[model samples]
Target: MDSFPLGVAPHSAVTIRFVEALPDPSPVIAEIIGGGRSPGRADRYCAGPWGLTVVVGLAADATPAQAAKAGALAAAALIGEAIEEAVCAIALSTEASVAFARAFRARLFRPLSLKRAPRAEDLCRLGALTLVAAKPKDAARAWAPWQAIAEGTEWARSLCAEPGNRLNPTTFARILGGLGDLGVEVEVLDAAAMAREGLNLHLAVGRGSATPPCVVVLRWRGGENDAAPSLLVGKGITFDAGGICLKRAAHMEDMRGDMAGAAAVAGAIRALALLKSPVNVTAVLALAENMPGSRAQRPGDVWLGHAGKTVEVIDTDAEGRLVLADALSWGCATQKPRQVAALSTLTYAIMAALGSHYAGLFATDDNLASALLSSGEASGDRLWRMPFTPADDPALKSEIADLRNCPPVGPPDAMNAAGFLRVFVPEDIPFAHLDIAAMTLKAEADDTLPAGPTGFGVACLVLWLMAKG
Candidate 1:
C-alpha cells in the first residue's frame, strides 16, 4: 500500500491502522480484533510492543460522508492517547479521500496555546496525516481540493477559538486583510468611510463599543474580469454582548463565536482562490461588536440603513439582521452579483426548529434553494429549507419603520429574520439566507466535528460555488 501525505498538518498526531480481511495480521492486532466487534467501529488498544493502536473499520460500500465521519471519529479517538505517525486510511477514492482528509484535520483542531508552557506537550501539537491512496494519479488529483477544504475549515475554526478581547473589529479586519497574500484582493472600509457611505444601521450596532466597526470586502477573480460573481455577505459580530438587552449571566461566553459566519465566508473565498477555481466570488463581511453602553440604541429605536430603509429595533440583541441588511444592500449595489447569500448566527429560533443537525436555509427561488440543498448533501454540512416569506408572519411589520429587526409578539423568529432580509435583496437576483445558529458550536465531540465550533458552511459554500463546474 502506498501512503500519500495530506498537505495540511493536524493539531495532534495520531496513528490509524487500516485493515481489511487480509490474512497476514500482526500478533497484537490479531489479539485485539479477536475480542473486537464489527465493521464501522473504531477501537483503541494498548499493545505491549506496538504501543497505542487505533483500529477503524470501513464498509465495502461506504459513502463519502460515512468515510469522512469515520475518519474524524478515529482521529479524535487517537488524540487523547498521544499516538502520532500514520493516520487512518482505507485505500479511498479521490472523493472519499478528500472527504476523510477534511473531517480528520478539522477534528484535530483545538484551542491555540498562547501562554508559555513548561513542557513541550503542554502546548498544542501539530502532527503529520498520511492517507493511503491506491495510485499516484489519485493522490495528485485529490491534493489541491483537499488542501483547500482543510485550510478553509481550519481557518474558520481558529477564528472561533479566539477570545473576544483579542478579536474585535479592527483586529478582525487586519486578519482578513491578510487574505491578500492568498491572491485575493481585500479592502476594508473603516467607520468613517462606512458612515460617509450611508451605512448608518451597520454603524448603529457598534455605537456602544470603543472599537470602531467596518466592512471587509474580499474579491477573488478566478473567472473572467467581467463575469458576474456570487456575493456572500456575512454578519461579523466579533462579540455579541446582547447590547442594551443583556443576555443571561450563564453561557454568555459563547458569544465569542458570533463571527463564525464571517470567518466561514472568508475561508470559503480563501479556498476558491487557493484552488484557482474558474468562478468569481465576492465576500462582504459586516464587522462589529454588540456591546451595552450609554450610546447604544435602545429597544424601539429606528435607524436608516444603506438601502434607504428604516429598521425598528424591537430587541437590541437582534442585531445580526441589522448589520446584514446594510451589508447586503451595500454589496449588491457595489459588487453587482448574480445572486446573494448571507450567513449569520442570527436567531435562537432556528435551533429550536432544526436543532444542530442542520442549518436553516431561506431562498427567494425554488431552483436556487434546491441547488443549495444538493450542495449541502454533497458536502455533509446539511441545510434545511424553510418555507418563509415576509408575508408568512405579519408581526414582522414595524409601526414606525420600513422593517422590524425582530417580531414583538408570537411567530417563528428565524423565519421572520430571514424574511426581513428579503427586502434588501433585489427581486432580479436570487438570494439565500443561511441562519447557522445551532450549527456553529458543538457541545460535544461527534462523528464529523470536535467539541467546539464546527466550520459549518465552508463546505456548503465551496460545493455550491463549484457546482457549476
Candidate 2:
C-alpha cells in the first residue's frame, strides 16, 4: 500500500513515508474538504509539490475540525512522498539532497535534481499513479509514456554536457557501435573511409581538429514488412571553434553543446528502442571537432562531397553544413529512406529570426514539411516552416565550385542553409533541414522543463516516427 490515490477517499486516516532523514519538521497542509462541497469542510488546499504525509477525517461526513485534522495529515504524508521521490530520483549526494529538501521544504514541491541522481523508478511510480480526478484512466496511462520520454531527454542533455576530450569522435563511434547489440546496425565511416568515398567536404572540416572525424550510421529495423526506412541525419561537431573563420573565445564554452543535435538523434534512437516501435528508423551522425590548427582547412578551400558535388568553403565557420552535406548525401544514397530529415546547429541566424522558442524547419517537399510541423507541435518542440524554392537556392551558388558552403550572409541564413542541404537531396526525394541551434541548449526558469541542455528534439522525433505509419 505504498501508492497514493486520486479522487475522494472514504477513510478517516492516511499515512505516507519520508524516505530521507530530516533535520527539521517541515510540514505541508492540503485541505480538501466537504464531500461534494459541504459547508463545514474546507474548500481549497495547498501542499508542497509532491510532499509526504496523509491527513485523516472522521469519515466522509466528518465535522469541520475532524476534516481539518485529516487534511493536514494527508497533505503532510502525500507531500513527503513526493519530496522523497524527487530527491531520490535526482540521486543527489545525501548532504545535497538533505540541504535541498530543507531549503525547499521537502514536505512540498519536487524539483528536478542537477544530475542523474536516484533511480527513475520513483518517477515512473509517480507517473503511473498521478491522475486528474476528472480524467483518471486516460491521465494515469499517459504518465508512464511521457516519463519514458523525459528519461531519454535527460540522457541526451547529459551527452551534450559531457566534455569534448572524454566523448570525441572515436569514443562516440564506439558508444554507438554498442547499439548494434540492441538491434541497431551501426556503421562508422572514418576520415580515410570518407575520403575514399569522395566525402571531401566532411573531411575538410575535420582536417582542422586533432581528433579524426567519423560518420556513424545507426539503423533500427522494426518494420519487417516495410520497404523503405525513415532517415534522420545529425551534425555532430564534438566541438566547434569556427576553424579558420574562428569564433571569439567569449562564450565559446557553450560550443561543447554544439553536438546537441547528434545527441538528440542518438537519444531518439534510444527512445525508439525503449518503446520498441514498429517503424524503420535510421540515424546518421557526423562526429567532428572544429579546431584552429596549422592543418585546419582555411576559407576558400574547395572539397567534394558524397554525391560528387564540390563545395567552396567560403567560411570554415560554416562547417556544420559541410559535414551534414556529406551525411545527407550518404543517407539518401545508401538508405534511400522514404523521407530524410537532417538537424544541426548550423547558424545563429535561426536564433536571430525565431529566437529560442522554436526550431526553423526548411523542407523541399510540402508533405514532409507539414508532417514535421504537425509532429513538432504535438510534441511541444515546435518548428516554423521556411521556404526553400529554387529561387532561394540561388544564394548558395558559387563561382569557384558547384556551390558555396554558405549563402549570401543576411536575414535568411537558416533558410539558405536548408536550401544548401536540399541541393544534395535527390530531386524526387522528400527532405527537411532542421536548424536546431537556438532551441537545443536554450532554457528558462519558468519553463515547464528546466534550462541547460534541453533535449528539445528527441520527443518530437519519436512522435514523428510513431506517427509515420
Scored by CA lDDT, what does every candidate get? 0.79, 0.67
Model 2: per-residue Cα lDDT over 1-469, one tens digit each:
1122211111111112123233222233323332232222222234434553232223423333343243333233333133323222222232222222222221122223233354442232322111112222432344334544555566677677666666678777877776666677888888888888778788888887888998898987888765698999998898888998899989898898888889888888887877777889899999998999899998888887888888888888888888888888888888888888888888888888788888999987888888889999866689998776465467788998888987646654776777788878888888888889998764442213323577778888888888883
Error of 1 at 258 (Å): 1.1
Q: How many residue pairs clash (N, CA or C atoms closer than 3 angstroms) in each of the candidate models, in the order given?
A: 0, 30
Regions more than 4 Å wrong, model 2: 1-82, 86-137, 389-393, 407-412
Per-residue lDDT tens digits for candidate 1, residues 435-463, read 99898998877776667778789988998
Worst 10 residues of 2 by lDDT: 6-15
Q: Give the TM-score of each candidate.
A: 0.89, 0.74
Candidate 1 wrong stretches, greater than 4 Å:
1-28, 34-43, 46-51, 59-62, 80-83, 87-89, 114-126, 391-393
TM-score of 2: 0.74
